[model samples]
Target: MTGLMAGKRGLIMGLANDKSLAWGIAKALADQGAELAFSYQGDALRKRVAPLAEQLGSDFLIDCDVSDMAALDRTFDALKARWETIDFLVHAIGFSDKNELRGQFVDTSLDNFLLTMNISAYSFVAVTRRARAMMPEGGSILTLTYYGAEKVIPHYNVMGVAKAALETSVKYLAMDLGPENIRVNAISAGPIKTLAASGIGDFRYILKWNEYNSPLRRNVTIDDVGGSALYLLSDLASGVTGEIHHVDAGYNVVGMKAEDAPDI
Candidate 1:
């Protein structure tokens, strides 16, 4: 281990299971000697997250529902009780109704639209508000985003809009926190077969399409994202902030399908 993060302590929000992007980020951080705390929303996930935390040699777990103000308050209160300050925070949370994920964007319901925005977009803001309080000494904040926010992906629909809003929030938050030496940024990762991704329609096809067309000729994995995240969260990226760094295998640069690509 490089011990690049040898003494840092931070919280990881929205980890669900082994295949989660959060899990990859957690492992990368832990391997670099960073101390970690994990947060899960409900009982079902509590069981899953506990073992993951233990695997990382961490027993600091908290129940946090970012959409709820009181739960957020309690989450940070618990964190503050344990550590007077933290060096970083990772937000890998997002959600949307599965039923709405398959249809046209025009048909998105108001309820689901609002719900998606609340969970996928605003939760970052909520958590950052509390996390910033503990970062008087300055720190790093990272969130996961996607290419769907910039280009229309079939079935990405409302979630795309939500991610767009989230990207904007990152820029604004970076500006708001820059004076404090706190950096805010995001990773627009390629499609990965995580639990949260299964909810999107024809996800497998999307994966395959990316494999054939991206400049790397493959879809990205959590490990790929983990490496990029590690850099952003570490002092390696101290000069960076408010950036939507793409970890999408160069997919964002393509204007048309590759000549060798096959139709999915």
Candidate 2:
């Protein structure tokens, strides 16, 4: 049971640092004996990702900018050359101009909107296409999303809209790939103080609000997210696909803030 992923190999995308949710999932998977390869968008992240991948007994780092189709082709090509197939893919990539993460969603510029959609939402589609090619026997694909996609979270802005699209893509892709026994799912995780969360406006307030109001009466950490991800990526979720599973400490179910909660 402990070696659930003992014979598996997969790719990890969007690892930034130790505190990243991707790092948490990678550690969990690696601890269960999953061999991993990592993708970094640029040279700076390459340096950061290399040591972390090495920590998991992997040095398979590839340079992939999902926004660029050519780079994605090269990424899978590299994987093809090394591993004939992969068992899973973890897509934790996302981005938006920090300037736009605040303010009203109506103020979203066309350029930024397109960029956010392409990187945050469509990148999953792009990478899944490549990953599916390598998963002839079928596999699992997981992406990181947020509760902001389902309901409004102040200042979540364009990223929320993008995540909405991402969640839909999971369903569509799941249908397209299910015949091959491939699965697609998303984890709508709760707040965690990672590098990405730092960009959101009033993030501290949002964290406090979730802590006060969520049924668990606290925010979730990357470890919490990692465990759920492990279940989804493992055979434990063999029957699960096209699901937007909530790892939000039951926050998504609440209709209103807790009556006894302190006002943020």
Candidate 3:
């Protein structure tokens, strides 16, 4: 019931602010007694991420862009300087051009498509390879995903395609690493009003719609996601791997709008 991660240490990548999903997961891990290191892309985010990391009793922050393989190498090298091995890894990173986020998927430009795939999907693959080297005795790896990958949502656009790729990567990585005791998984969270969500067109409507129609009759919070991440990352889920766990408040099961739901 307490200190589920009492002796664990890990790195959290892509925490933008207090409201970031990464913040929720990091806090959960820390509260359960995990030592955490954070990664930020630039000085601007360092200013924001540094203080938050302090709140969790962590001063270890690494600067690296996930899209850059050399930067990722340096990041793990820096991590190795402090801790030779890691118990887990939390990858809560993804991005797409706001301009492309709103338009029809058919209109997606090749350049943006590749860029989005590189950042939103391939980054997970890149980070996992590095993290695997640090988990010689076995470990858990988690990444954030969305329901948009499974079903078409207005304006989710190419990010959905990227998430689909990410979800599949989880399966393949799990198979590749399972023999070594490394587990790979993803959380397809429901919509939340995070900085990343603000880029999607008509996002407010998407939130409201999920609120009105979901079985829970409301949206999920970062804390809701945090609790689930805690379970997956902890020893509690030792038998689970290569799974796309849904933390969407039962919304993914709905067949249609609720009969009594108010129109969004």
Candidate 4:
């Protein structure tokens, strides 16, 4: 059980704490004997992420604010110098102004819209561009998404639009990198309480509503999302590319709430 990824190495982003979905996946991957490197957005998170990464036996921590080119380049350069061939890379970063996340989609400012797309959607492309160069044997790239990408999640607003584009990019990237054997995909996770999720309007109601109505009759956990991520990143999913795998406790598949479930 520990050997599925015994010699594989990868990098993961978006870990804010032990509760983060990225940390969950990192723990599982490390438990399965995969060596890991982690990136933090700034010095504060670096303080937090660095200790956990080391506890899992990783000295591969780098400071990478995805929006910065020099930082991104430095992060990958460190990995390239250390590991000549890598197996996977995970992109779990996303951002949108708190003000815009609560209001009508029409009210979203152009600045915030571009900012959200740049950090949330385009960062995947920006980092992958560098990460790809280091993966001479090809590798897996997985990003986190939400059902909001395909359908409107109230108050999700422009972030939803960014996710939709991110999903599309996954497919196009998969094809572009196929010749080199690198696979690209995204995990469309069910809602989980995170610092970012707290920005959305009516988030509390969304959580309760989803648990009572989804097919699994419960909300998803970080562990659930992490396991799905491990599968996509590992060789187990070699043939799975350009796909959006859902780990949302059957919530995304529902067309309507059950008759007994309360209305929104």
Tens digit of lDDT per residue, candidate 3, span 1-264? 259999999999989999999999999899999999999988999999999999999999999899889999999999999999999999999889999889699999999899989999999999999999999999999999999999999999999999999999999999999999999999999999999999999999999999999999989999999999999999999999999999988999999989998876
Q: 200, model 1: CA deviation in Å?
A: 0.4
RMSD of each candidate relative to the true structure: 0.9, 1.1, 1.1, 1.3
Model 2 accuracy (lDDT, Cα):
0.94
Count of backbone collisions within predicted model 2:
0
Question: What are the TM-scores, per candidate, against the unseen true structure?
Answer: 0.98, 0.98, 0.99, 0.97
lDDT of each: 0.94, 0.94, 0.94, 0.88
Output the worst ten-in-a-row residue range by lDDT, candidate 2: 1-10
- Candidate 3, residue 17: lDDT: 99
Error of 3 at 41 (Å): 1.4
Q: What is the lDDT of candidate 4?
A: 0.88
Per-residue lDDT of 30-86 in model 4, one digit per residue for the tens? 888889989888888888888889889987888888888888888888888888867
Model 1 scores a TM of: 0.98
